[model samples]
Target chain A: MTTAVRVAWLAAALSLTLLLCALSISIGSRSIAVLDVWGFLLRPEETAEAAVVTQLRVPRTLIAVVVGAALAVAGSLMQSLTRNPLADPGILGINAGASLAVVIAVAVTGIASIMFYMWFAFLGAAAAAVGVYLLGSGRRRTATPARLALAGVAITAALTALVQTIILTNQEAFNEFRFWTAGSLEGRGLEITGAAAPFVAAGLLLALLLAPALNALALGEQTGAALGVRVRRTRALTFLAVTLLCGAGTAAVGPIAFVGLGVPFLARAAVGPDQRWSVPLCLLLGPAMLLAADVAGRVVIAPQEVQAGIITALVGAPLFITIVRRRRIEAL
Target chain B: MTAAEMPTHQARLAARRLSVGYDSRKVLDGIAVEIPNNTFSVIVGPNACGKSTLVKALARVLRIQSGEVLLDGSPLSQYTPKEVARRLGMLPQAPHVPDGILVEDLVARGRYPHQGLFRQWSQEDADAVDTALRRARVEQLRDRLLTELSGGQRQRVWIAMALAQMTPLLLLDEPTTFLDISHQVEVLNLCRRLQREGTTVVAVLHDLNLAFRYADHVIVMRSGGIVAQGPPREVISAELIEKVFDLSCRIIEDPETGTPLVIPQNPDTAAKGS
Candidate 1:
């Protein structure tokens, strides 16, 4: 597609996402009119409706947007780095690593707060990424897609086993672990968003800087190197970016499944495989998908909300399958 | 300008006692050679004779274990990757093409070395891409997806991408691999055209006859070292073929081009005839 057309599409997508964000903020357990929501947003007051909008819905919406974009962009980078369409934080053991760490924090410190567990999650995610890289690359060999995928599977299985053992041994920790594992975007305040923002921002900035190199990398490592890309350096930075994005997102919202796996395919379908276009598209589309799903979670049960993670899985699984079946998955 | 006006264009590529290897085994050991400017040079040898390794070393894709590759009288390692890429481009054997990538976009990626952090997609990039597409004869297929093109057309598009690099030197490893005879000729003809336009072209070729017909200089290798290096007509002979390939062969002149052609003799057939 032409650049002008792509820019037009991006603009349309951004507008639609903004509309969805408004809908998410206005329509919750208590439905407020769009005008009232805007009035409250524009003018501060001590009214109950204003409090709901400012203290509750606004923080939730912001967290959803940030976490959603982080996961989606991280997923896209993972797929491009591994050259595997199926790659994501969940698939690559990143989320499992975070889950294990969060479980351990709860069991050891007896602190069930999401805020406190966030740090451990980031540490676990970074460690898992490094482990995967070392195992996949091995001695004297760069990580190929097949090798990376296999390494991810091994790490994920091991981490899941450890997490299960911790939860099973401690009944008190299991309750918190169960809720966190379901991946809800609830009860999180602006503090969580503030804490995760810098990491996510840094990751997004690095991703934008590396997009062109990632595009060349999709051609192959040797081809990327020949194109003047520092292949080893790009790979290292990509791992760091994915770590920051996924670590922060997983910490803010519990291991939200499928957003990272499914969103990139949608972005790639819209903008082709050029990372420069696809990564930005994912940034916008991811928040849109997450906010829309969060809205659905709030309304589907009316008065009682399902977690946003469940809604995304319900929507994302069939879409992912359709994509895989509709076209032959290209070999990396 | 004409070739006589320029006289000898300084050698842009040279290797000094370079050694390269993978894992623990050495592939090319202490071999040195220089590629003359504006010449279509072909490296040929039997399977696993390190012809590709030497090409890879020259392109800086393979790290030299000893000595250095010199570009314009400076060591290759001293220059940044983008600096080297600005002057040299390499087309690896069987490069992967991303699914659903348009031809023009793939060709445009070759401008990566010239693009900067803040400056990208300039008019010069556009012009280079256009010239490359026209020169490689893929302008008509620029909008098509790479997967949709035929083998010959795809190879030409890849050449167009390398051409878009706008480098003085180009190295291709088995550029004609997996193509039919006609497509092989088509790619070779494209390389010839590129050489004519003053691009130094070096390729690792399996077909000795094709190398002889197309290459201005031929480097023959055996067991990680140069067996002979000269103009194809002077260097290619029955003795060289037998020594390099471990096969008895008769060297005959081609009727069309008068380049040496090796026709291997089967020992059983020779004994029966005698």
Candidate 2:
């Protein structure tokens, strides 16, 4: 593809993402028009429409965009680091780690504040990633994709079991945990978004800076090393970046499923495997996917709403199966 | 040449009492050798004889367990990775190629060491990539995806990438693996041309005859020790082949190049012919 064409596609993707953001703010439970949302934005007062827009929809929309982009970029980095197309925070036990940490924090201390959950989630995500890395690299040879995936499966299973044990034992904790586990963008406010924004922003910055090295890494470890890339350092930094991304996003909105797994495939398909291009595209495509799912969830049951996590699973599972069934899935 | 004058063609890469192993199982033990500047040096050995291990050590992919590897009279560890890469380039056996990457983009990546955080994609990088593609005869395939190329074409593209690094010294581990006879010869010829153009080349080769034909200096090994090192005529003999490979063979001269060629003597055929 020509440079002109690629730039044009990127522009189109950006425009679509902006459109989704607008839709997310406008078409919630109240069904406000775009023009009305614009008018409300211009004049902030005690009007119910303005309150709904500023207090409710705007924070949710901002969180959606931030978390969506974070998960997608993290997914791309994970896939490249492990050279496994199936590697994602949700699939690789990272979300389970954060979820388990949150459950434990609430069950043990009975603190239901978002700040506590965010800190615990960050620590748990980092620990889980390190656990997975150690387990994968424990093999006699360098870690293969299958080995890393197996490690992820094992960690996910163990963490989920622990989470279930905690939630099943305490009824009150279960009530709070169930809502968070379902992964909805509703009822969240600016406080949650503000708490997670710095982490997501740092992760996004680190990922973009690491793009060139990630491209070399796609050529395999020894090859990347030969090309003057510091393989071990890059891998370490990638883990830190992924931790910040998955932890903060999960903490703010609670483990929304499939955005991390599905967005990278779409990004790679749209713009080839070069991380320089694919990573940025993932930033846009991820939010678009999440917001679209969130909007669909709101409208699917007019009086009530399906969670965004459920909707993403509904859409993402089939896409995942299709990718696997293809004759050749790109390895990195 | 006089003995004093010979020092002018000094070895740029030399290992002294080098030891390498993985997880306490030593693969190479106390080995010493020198790769002279501007020569096509080939290291040949039987399977599992530490040929790949030695090359890996030389390329800094494997850390030395003991002793030191010196590049241009300085210890390899003294230089930063980018500094070392600016002087030495390596092409590993069966390096991964990311899917859907254009050939030109792959070659341009060899400029990584030359590029800094702020210094990116300059005119010099473009010229180096262009020169590498033309030299490797893959310019026409520059815009094509790497997955679409044939095996030989892919190998040449990889070579083009290495060439774009523009290092004075190059190391290859079995560059001709998995290719047909004609393609193997083509790659070897390219290595020969690179040597002629003053890049010091070192490679690990399986084919003894091809090594003899192309190598200006040859190192034969058995069980992690150098068995012989010199020009092919001085180093390759029937006795050395039998000792190193455990295969009885008769050494003959190539009709076209007069390089040493090995004709293995099968026990059954040898008895019947006699």
Candidate 3:
């Protein structure tokens, strides 16, 4: 595509993302007017609508935006690092691993706090990342994308079953985990968003800085090294960033699936595989998608709501299948 | 045998008693070598004779266990990878091209070492990419998808990427592997042109005839040791070829390039002249 069209597309994506964020704040169950939302955003006041805006919608929007960026960035990083276009935190069992850890944390301590369970999320994500890599590897060589995706599916299935068994047996933990597993933004305040934002931010920063190295890595490891990219270091940093993003994202929202999987695919489809463009594109597209899911969830049933996770799955699974049918193996 | 010394020119990239290998296996054992500046050097050897290992070590792709690589009079370890990359480049044995990537897009990634996080896509980078495309004659193929290109075209695209790095030194490993003989000559010609343009080019080639026909300097290896190193005509003899390759052969001068050409002996006969 021409530069002008690409730039225009980029601008539209940003505007659309901002519009979604605004819509997320404005169109909750009660439906505040856009004028009122704008007014409240401009000037703080002691009003009930302001309270609804500040106390509820704003935090939900922030968490959606943060988690959206984190998951999408993590997914892009995984795809580039593994040379696997099909890679996603959810598909690769990272989210399942985090879910199991959070469940175990709650079952063990009866403490359902974000601060308390997020650490376990990181550990579980690390373990799953390593486990999938080992299992996915092809006969003494590095993992091919097909094998890695299969390994991811296997690991995801196993961990998800373990999560189910734990949640079913432990009633106390089930109460804490059910709302989370559905992946809703309801009843969560700024506290959880605050707890998760820094990690997401760090992961985003690392990803952005490592973008050029990732581009070099696209040309195999030895070539990347010859080009002065520290391959092992870049891979390690990417692993750390992916773990942080997935861990924090899973902890913030209970394993929200498909935002990571689909947004970056859309980003690459729009632009090319250049990480510098796609990664930033993911930041915009990711939130636009999740907030769309979240907003649609609010309006889908009006009073009673479906979870954002359910909506994304409804949308993302078809997209995933289309991608599978469209592309051959490990070409990226 | 020791390499012939040319005390006049200082070698920019040289190794010192380099000993490297996997555990319990020594691939290159205490081999010292110097690569002259602004010349086409080919490392030719039998299978597993450590030619690729030596080139990889000089390119700083593999870790050295017991020796040091010096680039431009400084130990390579002292310079950051990016710093070294500005002066050296390598086109690996089988480099992967990302599917659906345009040739220009793939070539542009060669600017990674020259680029920084905030300082991406400068005028210098664009100029380098253009120059590389022109130099490798792939400028016409700039918009084409890399995967859609022929094997020879893809090889030139990879060489274009290395050229885009704008390094003074370039190393290629079996760059003509999958290409036909004509394409092999095409790649070797490109390397020759690169050498003419004042870039030191080192290629690890399996084809001794092509290696000798094109290389201004040749490093011959046998069983992890440098058997000979000098101009190809002096270094590549029938005796040396037979000793290194265990193949009886006759060394004939190439009529086109006036370089040594190896013709294997007929095993059934013991004739001195054909």
Candidate 4:
């Protein structure tokens, strides 16, 4: 681990992400050539080959990259913020919160418009995060990481149960929710990507700025304060950033598991617990993972398709296991 | 000394009628103490006597229930945390080490108060970190991970981090508690050296003899109140130890340094009150 090697890894990962993005656009139900994909990317034409590239594959590829990066940032931030190596975006029920809101929207209006429900998902995620924070912050000023995690688990459980009951009773809601709960990128257009990307961008900015402070926080709460970090305010802002990230990701695609949980560990294993390095590395690694999974899913069963979320867990869990077996996990 | 050379100065670091507590229970109340400039000061007391509370309150780790702490002749509350951090550094009791963090990087974190988003890792920060590593005698372990270091080495690295803060005044809460006799002495010696190097050092120490041996100024406490303050030789006596700790002890001289040393009486002779 020299600086040169780390920089090389970053460059390689970025190149891999770009390669995967290109591959996702070309290798799909139609398997367009690289040259044709390039032409379609520059100026989508009237032909059917171009239609597959322009109308369908490109938007999903963009959504996959954006949501993947957002989840990765959210997961890394959540893990460090809670100081729980096991922590991820779903630990605080952001996914469950968004899922519950979307299901409620479907049951009420029977409309599946991305624009209509994305806002509800975002609000629900923020509300759940705020609720967990309120419950976790102790009677006084002490907000232990373990206490906060327990609060998250509790809220996530309650909201998930509510979502399950609502969807089970409403047949139409269940049919609509089933597609999303499977975590597909199919049929999601650029409008969904457009609605989600700004929040993710804002979150990524906040997370990068919060990086050095999170490094100090790895030392512990009292030590963080001793190092002149404003512990309470920093944690609050971290919550806000995580909310935006997880809310937007889960809103755009259904909760894409494994990328958020596994990629951060990969980032930390390559580097140490320095969030300055881990956070940025995660941004590159996350999308590379998701788009690769998305591309693989388009032909995993041939003519039939698996969702990107299913492929990620199927591929990611074993990859995670293999990685941990090779390299010991870093302590938070 | 010339009259102009030895001029009058106010105590830049002092607490006035300070009260601190968690929840409703008060740990320290109406306590006042001043750290002499460029000297090592130690606060010693029985368990639960609020010495740690006093140090933490001064460090601004604990919220003051009433009154105020002043640093550089201004109320500590007036300065932002980073501004206060520029002048004062503290090491909390048994501070945790981030897993897999390298010694140099850990020391570099002391630059937080000085760094902004744009001006990270300036030349001055690099020099400060190097100086800290050399001064704390951890330059040899600069590339070592905290998990690989021995307890004494880890403590020294932590001190290096505080030194890297490059503050004029340093506060440590129970710096020597978890160490063996030799490690305890090692940490205390480092603190004393920092004082000699012109950094004002304040620490809460549990070992009465060690505090007396190392501290130029001492504050003794009982039940959250300041019992005595001044040089350890004048402030600590057999009567004071008995009154404060309920232990019968005799004061003797350290042959090497001629500092006051406390020798407790045998249990057969002193175990009557309980």
lDDT of 1 by residue, B1-274 (tens): 2212332326789887888998679899888787878999999999998988888788787788998888988898998888888999998887888877999999998989898899978999999999999999999999899999999999999888988999999999899989999999999999999999999999999888899999999988999988787789987889999899999889999888999988989899989988
Instruction: List candidate 4 stretches off by more than 4 Å.
Output: A318-331, B1-9, B271-274
Residue pairs with clashing backbones, model 3: none
Q: Who is ahead in TM-score, 2 or 3?
A: 2
Q: Each model's TM-score, in the order given?
A: 0.97, 0.97, 0.93, 0.95
User: On a 0 to 1 DockQ scale, where is model 2?
Assistant: 0.70
Clashing pairs in model 2? Answer: none
> Highest lDDT among the candidates is held by which one?
1
Instruction: State the lDDT of candidate 4 residue by residue for B46-81, as single tens digits.
Output: 999998888888988778999889898788899888
TM-score of candidate 3 against the unseen true structure: 0.93
- Segments in model 2 whose C-alpha atoms lie over 4 Å from true places: A139-141, B1-9, B269-274
Q: On residues B1-274, what C-alpha lDDT tens digit does candidate 2 reach at each position?
A: 2112335227788887789998888888988888878999999999999998898888787788998888888888897777777888888887887767789989988888898889877999999999999988899999999999988888899988988989999999899989999989988998999899899999999989999999999988888877788789877899999999999899999988999999999899989988
Lowest-scoring 10 consecutive residues by lDDT in candidate 3 chain A?
A1-10
- Write down the C-alpha DockQ for each prediction: 0.68, 0.70, 0.68, 0.66
Candidate 3's C-alpha runs over 4 A off are A1-3, A31-51, A130-151, B4-9, B267-274
* A206-321: candidate 4 lDDT, tens digit per residue: 99999988887777777788778898889989988998998888888888888888889888778877788888899999899899888889988867889999998888778767
Ranking, DockQ, top scorer first: 2, 1, 3, 4
Candidate 1, after superposition: displacement of residue A88 in Å? Answer: 1.1
How do the residues A1-332 of candidate 3 rate in per-residue lDDT, one tens digit apiece?
45566677689889999999888988988877889887987898899999889888999999999888999999999998878888899888899888888888888888878788889988999899888878988565466777988999999999999989998898765787888888887767789999999999999999999999998998998899999999778888998899999999888887888898898888888878888888988988888998999999999898889899999999888988998898775457
What fraction of correct interface contacts does each candidate retain?
Answer: 0.62, 0.62, 0.79, 0.72
